[model samples]
Target: MINLALLIFLVVLFTQIVSWVGKTVLQEVAFAVYSRVFLSGTASKQRQLRKQVLAEKAELGWTSSQDEFAKWAKLRRKLDKGIADLEKINTTLTSSKTSFSVKFNSLLWILMTGSQLFLVWWYRKQPIFWLPQGWVPKPVAWILSFPSAPLGSVSSGAWGAVCKRVLQSVEEIVKAILEPTVVPNGPFPTAPFPAQSQSQPSAKIEPITLEHEKLD
Candidate 1:
């Protein structure tokens, strides 16, 4: 009979490894597909535009860049809407809450991990994969040495990814809400009024008329 505790440990370790590998592979694949289809020649241009917009905003100050910012903000909202539309289409196609790509990747990860755990179970009843001591590659040896530790770190990485996505979403939402507020008020026509000085008013001069009647 296989030791239950050992089986559990191997299962968890393999799951972590599979999750890491799957995420890495899936990201590369997804980026390739997304860039080829949607971004194509525009990825570099978009990056340049973002840098230019940020530079203009920083140099001119926020109040002055209202029109430029509004243009950028409108583009941003359109991009977000496109992403939401893609997600909606994916959800409908997969009949799942998230995208079909995500679900498929997840399912593949589970199968890969389960197969590995089954191999470990078939070969040994021990809770851990013990490494033979001599002349192994340093990197492989290092990984094998701390399987349990890496599993904990894998969970940490997952949590960090989730937190980063949440923060990005919140940032986008805040930007959307505040974008209109930054618009410069339209310039108004004004009559040019002469500036008043602070000096005392000049005294009025009165002509003397008393001498002329007596002389006549």
Candidate 2:
């Protein structure tokens, strides 16, 4: 009988431990995926755009030939296209990340509630060790024997509420990160005026002797 009781105790303990571990792992994975894929990608794309803009500005200063202007225009168009693509991708990823976090949190809550109930049931089956000297009802003794189960249930509920809040916070953060800031287009500086000619042409001189010889 003692061995049987110990076996039951071990089973309940193991189940609770596994359930907790599973919840922790699920939360970690959710966070990792959001940070690594969604957040990082958005940041990286923005940084690349910024770098390209800087490089274009640098080229404009040194550019002399028309070919250089054409090359710069091509690069600028490519960068603009890239930025647009990244914006679309970021929107999609943000939606996906939010959905995944909500589902994961819901699963955690379900697992926690079920495990608590199972633990309570398991604990009630075990025999009570201590009882009041006076007459104590069987039902009362069963309830008193496993105080942890009720506490566990309450704890699980509170935890689920907290997890839901956390998931909401994460969603907000992902949305903020993914949303690209609208940078207003600045006016491009006008090109420098071409250099003017420095030297003036000398006036034409006519010979006077040719008219005097013709008259003689």
Candidate 3:
């Protein structure tokens, strides 16, 4: 029997991979990855050629302004060549992109996610961890024990859920650490001149003289 630690590790690792890479991207690349691995002979050669064309096109970057007609003409020719080669390869690989995509993606989901679900179900009745009795309230204990697990024990389903959540949090922290901080735009220049202020009439000040001085 595998130790609880090993089960936790597997669940965490798979969850992190699926969560980080994203399911959509994995599905998109499934057919591309599969053909190279499982096909042979001419199919393998076509895959290799397609890969080479893609790498070369990526290196060429996007088409820019045609400042020099000669250079622009050459670039355009190379771009067209790459596109033609890709189309040829795609046509050779499968009759329909939509049909092939659905087939490979479904296979990937069945193999990856299906296995995870099976593992959790197979171990549903078993407890991953045996906690001390009376440590938690009856309701809390029941939740931890859930399904068929004995009270005061942590069920496989609950523990796997916790482990996956913790791993996802760590993945987020790692991404945040690797992300570069954006420097704010430089200080913008203010108005060239101050605005003119409205002026009000100035009141004349009268100085008061002492009574003795006035009398004198």
Candidate 4:
């Protein structure tokens, strides 16, 4: 009975660790990878777009910390539209990159979860001949087990929702940390300029005289 409880406690602890890292580290790593692959060849444009959004937020006396959810939504819409345009231009590259990232991240999490389970299984066997019996104290295990119950209950997809909520708080802290002491003078540059489409602009040429004439 005691061994059973200890084993369960250890499993819960390891699961919580995996969930925490998934929320914090893996989320950011995924974002960085996605941005690098999707935004390739458009680093300058992306920077300009981000600056433009920041400038708008500043003009409106808003940051991610502010109560203006509408402002954030507007910014997101603009950014999404820009991303859509880029994706259209590089459809194959974007699709391949996204597929690879999803598979890679899934494999990483599987390996991490598998190793944690293996460690707990190994510890349960008590391979050592003689040592201090208990590693995880009973009282400490009980305390950890309390939260671990709810954590274990949460579904896999639920973590993404939880992470999004957690990131809201984190985003505010990041905004405060990044707040500039010295503000820039001018407004940020606008969205990446639109590319020329099907229609072509008409051109005019000036006639030249026998001696010399200017061309327009």
Candidate 5:
């Protein structure tokens, strides 16, 4: 039989990665080739527009003579018109991409989350692993066991939760390590210390008076 613990970990890890992919890698499946006919040639239309723009640029560059101002101006106008068309395509692509992502990613998330839930239900009575005897209190062990699993056994529910938490922790640590830190433009300023001086007292004239009295 396949190891339940390994399966649970892999599934949880995969779901998390899928969630990240839709968010970070590509916002819309339609714009990327990773999607197979999902967008129904909408992406192809965008490609065609891009090719048209390139063709316009090349044709104008090679054939259109600059010797005649009128001809050059006419070609320039055509190029500008093609560019405007390209911009329209871009605007449409952006809005449609956002629309597609909202629907696709929402559905994707539901499916992925549901798969985990299904696994829990299907193996509700099964244990991913067995905990050492007396390792944890009865209440805690029961919670980990979950559903109908026997005591001192870790059920799918607990294992899935642990896997998710571990993945989140790892992701957080990675982001912390890879994220750029803002440093000050210069070193911190230090305050100067106050100056202190000690003065010595001068010798008194009592010695002169004693010597004078002795001499007198």
Candidate 6:
């Protein structure tokens, strides 16, 4: 009976360790995969669009100015329009990116929770060695059992809850960390910004001309 008790304790301890390891690995892997597949891809697409816009802008130039000031005004308007269009595109991209990240984060927590639950159920039938032996005196057994019962239950539940909550908290933190400091949506809470503002707009715009300008 003493030996049996020791064995059970070891099993319980081992399972706890396994649970911890599983949670850690899952969290890390999930975050990495999400960043790589979804986050990185979104960023890359946005970058490509920006580069294409720049190239288009570079193509538009004034070879011969029939109406220098009027042409300049037209060009300025066109540039502003292009920039506004790019801004809209960027907004859409950013919104989609954020939405994907949030969904991915939520999914990760779900997976972690599911995995932990499965592990718990798998080990449920296995006896914990730390538990007091029934053969022992009532007082001794009760005393020994007290620690494992409460501690074990609390630790298990806490771990599970913490895993879920931590994942959610982490997502919120990431948004706070990555989100733009300046609110583009104005002071009042009207609507959420389309994407995180990574870089501020430049003070001066470099003028360039394109041979054939096309509006999208």
Q: What local distance difference test score does each model get?
A: 0.51, 0.57, 0.72, 0.53, 0.79, 0.54
Question: Runs in model 4 with CA error above 4 Å?
Answer: 1-18, 21-25, 37-39, 42-87, 90-97, 120-216
Tens-digit lDDT string for candidate 5 (131-166): 999999999999999987888999999999999999
Lowest lDDT sum, 10 consecutive residues, model 4, at 150-159
Question: In candidate 3, where is summed lDDT lowest over 10 consecutive residues?
Answer: 193-202
- Collision pairs in model 2: none
Q: For candidate 6, what is the lDDT?
A: 0.54
lDDT of 1 by residue, 61-180 (tens): 543336698766755665555556555544443343235467656766665555544544443323233335555676654444343323212222222233445555666787698787
Higher lDDT: candidate 2 or 6? 2
lDDT by residue for model 3 (1-216), tens: 879657666856875787678877876677567656664554866777677777766645654445566765676677788678767767766764567777766766665677567766777788878888789889999988777788888887778777778887887899899999997799987867643443555667999887654564
* Candidate 1 wrong stretches, greater than 4 Å: 1-25, 36-38, 62-216
Whose TM-score is higher: candidate 5's or candidate 6's? 5
TM-score of 2: 0.36
How would you encode candidate 4's per-residue C-alpha lDDT over 34-118 as one tens digit per residue? Answer: 6688666565565565566566656545546357778777766776676665555456555655776677667656555664455
Query: Candidate 4: what lDDT?
Result: 0.53
* Winning candidate number (TM-score): 5
Residue 154 of model 1 has an lDDT of 23
User: TM-scores of the models, in the given order?
Assistant: 0.23, 0.36, 0.56, 0.28, 0.59, 0.36
lDDT digits (tens) for residues 1-216 of candidate 2: 555334434444444555546766866677777667657866677567667656765665566547587876766676577667667766766776677778877765555555545544555434323444445565554344444433212222233333445555666788799999987699877877755443455667987675545664
Off by over 4 Å in 6: 1-45, 52-67, 117-216
Order of candidates by lDDT, top first? 5, 3, 2, 6, 4, 1
| Candidate 6 per-residue lDDT over residues 1-216, each given as its tens digit | 454334333444444444655745655666667657756865676677677667546644542345576766666677677677678767876676567667765765555445455544544433343433345566654443342343222223333444456555666787799997875765766766555444555467788876886888
Error of 5 at 90 (Å): 10
- Model 3, C-alpha of 183: deviation from truth (Å): 2.5
Highest lDDT scorer: 5
Q: For model 1, what is the error of residue 83's alpha carbon versus the real structure, in angstroms, after optimal superposition? A: 17
